[model samples]
Target: MSAGASGVGGAISAHGLGGAKDLPIPSELAIAGAVAALVVSFTVLAVAWREPRYDAATSGRPAPAWLDRLVSSRALAVTARVLGMAFFLYVAAAAVFGQDSLINPFLGTFYVLLWVGIVPASLLLGPVFKAVSPARTISMAFAKVSGVPEGQGLYAYPARLGYWPAAAGLFAFVWLELVYPYSTDVGPVRLWCAAYLGIMFIGSALWGTTFLERADPFEVYSSLVAKLSIWGRRDGVLVLRSPLANLDTVVPRPGLVAVVGVLFGSTAFDSFRESTPWLQLVQSLSGSRVWPDTLALIAFSAGVALVLTIATMATGVTSDTPRRALPDLFAHSVVPIIVGYIVAHYLTYFVEYGQQTLIQLSDPFSRGDNYLGTADLQVDYWLSSHPTFLAVTKVLAVALGHVVGVVAAHDRAIKLLPPRHQLTGQLPLLAAMVCFTVGGLYLLFAA
Candidate 1:
């Protein structure tokens, strides 16, 4: 057997750790944390909306001094623009030079990472990409072209509808990723990418010049951070002027990192499991039974729910109601939806393919191959040569996985966060982060 095939095969056979019927306690615990986060976010929002004073701490604040420097730094702006241009260029090159066959794995993996990981994480992190966003970079380029002002006062908060819309949009994105596998040919992929880029460009055009002045979610979050960092000062202006900040002001909570880690880790785990033949083999052997599959499916659903709930709680806790606040909307509604998309998409892959498919794909290559570099080609040809029904089934399985991810993400976001938290908003995002991070690490390395 070729070294590559041999290694893959060895990984597959080592899957005998345990049966799939068992549910890890860590997974269950993580789910509990997710639930708590949701409840807390909702409670806080409800209280704040019902009473105006709840928002007093969060409201008020000129842009921070550092923010002024950050936005106006020519060095940072140039670097961002360069990277953004590079990303688009790479995509274009891949489309032009890469063969269709070569594109599948890359596309599949890329879709998984984008929807399931990056999108959701960004939402949770509060316009995280804005600081280093390619779109932001592109926007900056457009700003230069249009002669927009570049100063601290330029970036301000605009409106608040909670975070639901962002969440919904994220859910839609995940659905697209999951459905891509089953969708007809690669035509959809091209269309999707084009659409994404177009939307980004249009949004940039609309806000590039006035992004700072506009009441956006990011501005609110930044403002809130700046406010919390201020000590012994009621005046927002003075708070911004203080250059030396304490850890408590800057690091909202130690747990927030964990929450981000777990949310992000789920996607990472999905990718690792998908790529690592050994992990798949273990999962297959343990989860092959109907009961095991059912358990896994349930856990997957629970995880999605947890993400939405957490977002709702976080938003509600942070914002005051009847304010129609922009930051609260983005932080609570938008971020969670993104996270949902990521979790749902990856979960779909797990449910549809399970571990058996991976094991089977690794089988033929275990025995020595007569053909030299043609092993992958042989495998592909063999799969194509299979009975029509079998080939179709395999393709459908792959497609279905993506679909499940999208559905779960969207449904969870739409159904869960908004209503519950509006009445009593209080979410513990930082706490959730700590729990998720610890849980994820346990799953990845210790478990």
Candidate 2:
């Protein structure tokens, strides 16, 4: 993805947060990935299990008692909260007092460590954000001091609001990073963070941690990706389960479709926004480009939701399951596809900038103080340097994600659709998945 530069003092590029785009993935690799996606889609449709293979109640065996105790320990919880708060305050100091330039660690932390690092952290460790979310920690502390029980809100969390707040928040973040012209400017981003923290505090005060779980974009997104990890819980005990089985445990609630739509759509929009054609068109306008970029973001996000809703609901349903409810129910199937494409889109950016952020962190105020002792370290540009290997990895990752998504959807179809219509019901959704995968590969190849 390529864009005009946005940061102060010429430190950042127009392409938003990433420094330089990897060379467009070779066309041959893109074609190979698209072909693999097609083969996996039909293969799963043909030979995959006809019966539903996962159940939260019976899928996994509990971990050993010692491990469970260690993981669930109060000390560990308290330690995590302390660390989260400390890190938040440290970054707050930077944004409040540091230089308004690229040298400021605040920009890198916000753009790189948070925006990109969350994906891999969630993939490897289940719901990593939930454990370390500063807002959640602060809200819990307030509750304790106020003599309120944890998770007890003034009113029950509205089930109908499930994940919608998070969808909005995620959209706002992408808009800030990709659409907002002064995104890298210290003041605007700091203000945005302040508003976000304020809202999270207010929302949680009203609805308890349930608000954080559902409304916090990073938490929701991380938790969604965490579903694809081997870690899970059954009957209050941690257990290891296959990714597919773990993914099946996702209890689809209202706005689940919107959440997935924003996640996938925003990533696609990131690539689309940077294309030469879009850049030329938007730049040619005499007025501000903000209007066009905002509309494109909205279109991309809403388009994904619309397509998914239609695809999932197009199927014939049993009397017990309403067609209207199918979209959210089937939303979990797209999580892998989103994760795969995100990897393709952000792999180099994350690896390179993530290291850069760490080094920058040592000199948060840009005075060249090496507080964390990482000031002398150099970012290894190996991934960016080896464009060919990076391209192949991206293609393979996308192809693998497509295969898992297809299998997950197939299992769900058998469970939800009438026996007579199960296979037929899946065709539209399968086609939608194929379109998404192919379209993603095209972005990789062309952009």
Which candidate should be chosen as best, given TM-score against the real structure? Answer: 2
| lDDT string, candidate 1, 166-279, tens digits | 333333343343222333134556565566556555644654433432322233233333222332122333223221121112222212322322234333333233334544
Cα deviation in Å at residue 339, candidate 1? 6.2
Clashing pairs in 2: 3-14, 4-14, 5-13, 5-14
| Model 2: lDDT of residue 163 | 90
- The Cα error of candidate 1 at residue 389, in Å, is 38
Over the full model, what C-alpha lDDT does candidate 2 score relative to the true structure? 0.82
TM-score of each: 0.40, 0.95
